[model samples]
Target: MENPKKDSKKINDLEQNYKNQENTTLTTNQGVKINDTNNSLKAGERGSTLLEDFLLREKITSFDHERIPERIVHARGSAAHGVFELYESIEQYSKAGIFTDVNRKTPVFVRFSTVAGSKGSTDLARDVRGFAVKFYTEEGTWDLVGNNMPIFFIQDAMKFPDLVHSVKPEPNKEIPQAASAHDTFYDFVSRTTETLHNQIWLMSDRAIPRSFRMMEGFGIHTFRLINDKGESHFVKFHWKPKLGVHSVTWDEAVKISGADSDFHRRDLWDAIEAGHYPEWELGIQIVPQEDEFKFDFDLLDPTKLIPEEMVPVKIIGKMTLNRNPENFFAETEQVAFLPGHIVPGIDFTNDPLLQGRLFSYRDTQLSRLGGPNFHQIPINRPIAPANNNQRDGMMQMDIVKGQTAYFPNSLGGGCPHLAKIAEGAFDSYEERIDAKKIRTRSESFNDHFSQPALFYRSLSQYEQEHVAEAYTFELGKCMHSEIQERMLWLIAQIDEDLANKVAKGLGLEVPKSIEQPINQAIGADADIQKQQPPKKKIYLDKAPTLSQANTKFDSIATRQVAVLVAKGFSMKNFKKMTDVLEQEGAVIKLIAPHGGKVICDENMEHKVDAAIMTTESVLFDALYIPGGKKAVESLKKESKFIKFINETFKHCKAIAVDNEGEDLINESFVKDYKDDKAVFINKTPEDFVKAMAKHRNWDRRTIVKNIPV
Candidate 1:
């Protein structure tokens, strides 16, 4: 009768305490002790060192070969280890044990990466982000390797090499490190008609996500879901963030790259360390197999998307990342994810890109991991035991003891026979494929402009303007005039207004008309041609959800807020405001003239997180300049401090000032000091806290002028 659950919790807590205390460190590879590590062994203190210095030689040699070659794409990445818990069973949809068990929890590892960057590139690069999740289920490991955008730039895998070559740094000069705004990329865009939809997304806010946790992920290609009854349905996978989608402005993103190259990685690590686990809801869009051709676009086309309005995403499960990797190289770097590494109950569709990826991933891993035996690595090994007649290769970790290596041998007694269908053995979906051998896109895959136009027309006015601005900025960097003109003409085809707006920004004239051409293939199905253009379906009257502006903006959790203070700052008001905001899950940092402790009027000193010279306004979400007669007076004389406040205001972020601090704003010639929704003066800490939760003030952009270029 005496609460058994409480007793069990107490025992578990005691065990955890003992585990926490069992930690030790500091030893060389040979278990040798070195007292001084400040400097390596040298001759006569500052002279050239000798080879006899074993410790110095060992340390330097190890450091030299520390890094491995990064991925060809998705080179810049961040990762976390977590577990996925099923909320309910969907046994009718599939026979996979993980999906059919309501109370089961499966271990998972997720990696988020930028597509075009090198390992040392900036996190805020305007590139597609890879969202790859690997699940260790009871049957085998399943990898859902996807990207933040639901669609891709190419329809077939054959064009992948060309697409990557154009987007990467130019072969001759490698001038840009992690940028797509180049002549080669633009040239490819003009020729590849199927890339139109993804090009629009690239120009949208989706390209520059504020953080990995705030972005949505998609499987990109169509897949099949077969239930126990052998019934198949085409499906698309989605991972919607619980905190909602958010993005930084182009100017801010550019500044942030210089200010902090690891901005997104730092955000994710800090959130998990602070106990703010990022969450995402798993959703799927289902289309009956018989009705696959009912849609205007072909299901096999990777460049097209099935609008959510036509086939709504059904939310089924949730994945939460609550832990960070213990070692960057051992866990995050060595982890290999393949689209073909799927378990039972999950099968592939006949999408050409997916088919090519199935072959490319395993082949690439052989060279990248140094051999075919990469699965023997601890990070890549399956949790479910692997048993087969397959033998040794480079880096082989296992030894099979059997007289006969071949299957169906009498010496081995025909052992290791195939398991029954009831067992969790993988079998491809039994959909019939009776078509003649061909290597061309279906006729239904012809239309590439309708969805791009729909996406352009659905955005909010501010978002639409940003897209236009992004297109102008990217095209402006191109040195070739013809490339720019060709891209502008393509944009005109998608939406004439968008083309004109971008042209105006670039100081060029919009083309009066653009040419359209009929299909002429160079592959196996060269005779294929459409008699009519693909019809556009009316998905929504206005798809507000497609825009990042319509996402959630209520939470200020993990948001960095700058509190400007100096000597003789108010301790009472500072503590009061920070306490409430901190309780509401905001991160507060004090910025002063120097990084040392600042003395308050109440005789309390507080440590400054950063000094004015080292910290910029672009690094924070909002600014709060607290009140103190002396503190405000000191800040008013400092140009850097004044510019910091002005720039924050210019960025349309929330700004709060106390009475004494408000006086300094009025004296400064930033703008009219009229207190509005953005500029809060003489407000209570509660009121200021509420205002900061809105993320940013979109209305302020309309009034501000002479904004930073």
Candidate 2:
């Protein structure tokens, strides 16, 4: 009834009140004001964590239950059934049967996943890959849940929720999917200096692996191995892929996401189904208990790794994933892994992050898989007899025979009794822990910049350039100038050249100083300046193992090779090339102008794998075109064929053409690269195989920048 202007003003005020949070204080869902949420409550600065930490429980519980059925972090996953065969017994290191029994073929289930994405997100996301393995040994089910990166963004498990929240899509506007090139992620990474080590890893090509079979897996945390003599030694786990480490370029990753969002998932399933099983050697780096403090960095720090140059990996066994899951929802979806599921010889360490995970993983499964009875699921059940007195809950699939639901009951004749320590029973490692309970981290974990600097310096020239470009792209997306400046300043601490490269790309200067206190992981009353990361140190000149350039290149098994053909493709040239390729276990896919069968020059009809517009160049590892005048003429009419060849050259993949096939290459951007080392012209099939085995012609990346596709 009042003036119209008054009504409009009232409506605007209401909108601001409901949407804006400028002056609001951060509080828990229960309305409890929190002062420090970065570090969990521990026994001492570096002692074992305490269970009285309610803040950690509440925050992680909320995060674990945020989504129903699908995992909150590693939502989109692909898994397989495998078997682990020990090559040699390491009886001196551990008493675990899997480590000591060389004749045993332990059954295993492995799940590979991408973090910071939903169940429906694209597989080619530039994000951390989750590499979790569940080993069903005679002792028990040991779950070695880890990631593709050797380190993580945060040091403590307490900040895991915060880390995931920052990298996840923004709540109000879920615009970006399966990506970290956004504002909120970098804002958190810049403030949390501990994240710098693993942050540099995410900015590298390792985040965009070419295939799940080609990427390495890491335990990421230090664990203790107790021998039969009760001696404890600190150890780290590594999984070296038999196919070697490989990755795609950022440009290729972008296009691949559009072309085949299920590239990795499909590749893995096809390889296993085609009898080309993926294999990875299990390796361990064992350090004596007395030698733990010998390194420049803390062994317990989750954000650092012991350089392989210092301690070489001792290959013990191999794991071969020879079978695909029968049902995705029943096996892959409902499978639960718990870090606490360890045998007698394998035990936990006091790493704060690992300490928190022992609780977090089990808690997450309780909520995700319905209840405590999830272990009864066929995929999660242990091989050894589970004679516990535990009772029913949601989704209880087991039926107990006796009426005794409690232990130490004579009514059930105490039949489900515990085994003695001598009868292969599990025993916790008796590590000494005498310290006061406190909510702080050790000073040893403060040197965050040193390892990141070492990692950047260790990379090859091409890898380093990719890192710079990645940083530039990620930071350039940030709208806030202050956040970008802060990141530029931090990157400068790692390397001046890298920082300058990113800064130049962003059209901004690398600031000499930033106003905010660096490293916000300190407690509410702790000294901020003391917790700040120290100056970057150069412990080693380079770790060659850090670069994919030094990976194995002896085989090209399961490599997808695209054979461009038409109605009159050269059967002679095709046979010569494909015979050698198939012998080496490379997959040959025929791409033509149209689908279905096409007749060759010899009047033989062959099936088509994909049509010109139906497939993309980024989906294959190499390209081959057989010699045929009619084939070249038909290929020239299809514009996508030319674009496909141009993209193959742009990505620096191997390319080979024979006789008139060169005519097709001449029509595309590959014509200018006649002298390129990996671009073969009328070459022998052995020569082409040799080039394809190298994965890609990385040197060609520098000169092919101007190629239009």
Measured by lDDT, the strongest candidate is: 2
| Per-residue lDDT of model 2, residues 69-167, tens digit only | 789889999999999999998889899999999999999999999999999999999999999999999988999999999998888999999998999
lDDT of 1 at 610: 96
Candidate 1, residue 512: how far the Cα is off, in Å: 3.3
lDDT of 1: 0.78
TM-score of each: 0.87, 0.96
Q: Count the backbone clashes (under 3 Å) in each candidate.
A: 0, 0
RMSD of 2: 4.0
Residue 629 lDDT (model 1): 92
* Model 1, span 559-672: residue lDDT tens: 789999999887877888888889878899999988889998998878889999997898898888788999988887778888788778877788877768877677654448
RMSD in Å for all candidates: 18.6, 4.0
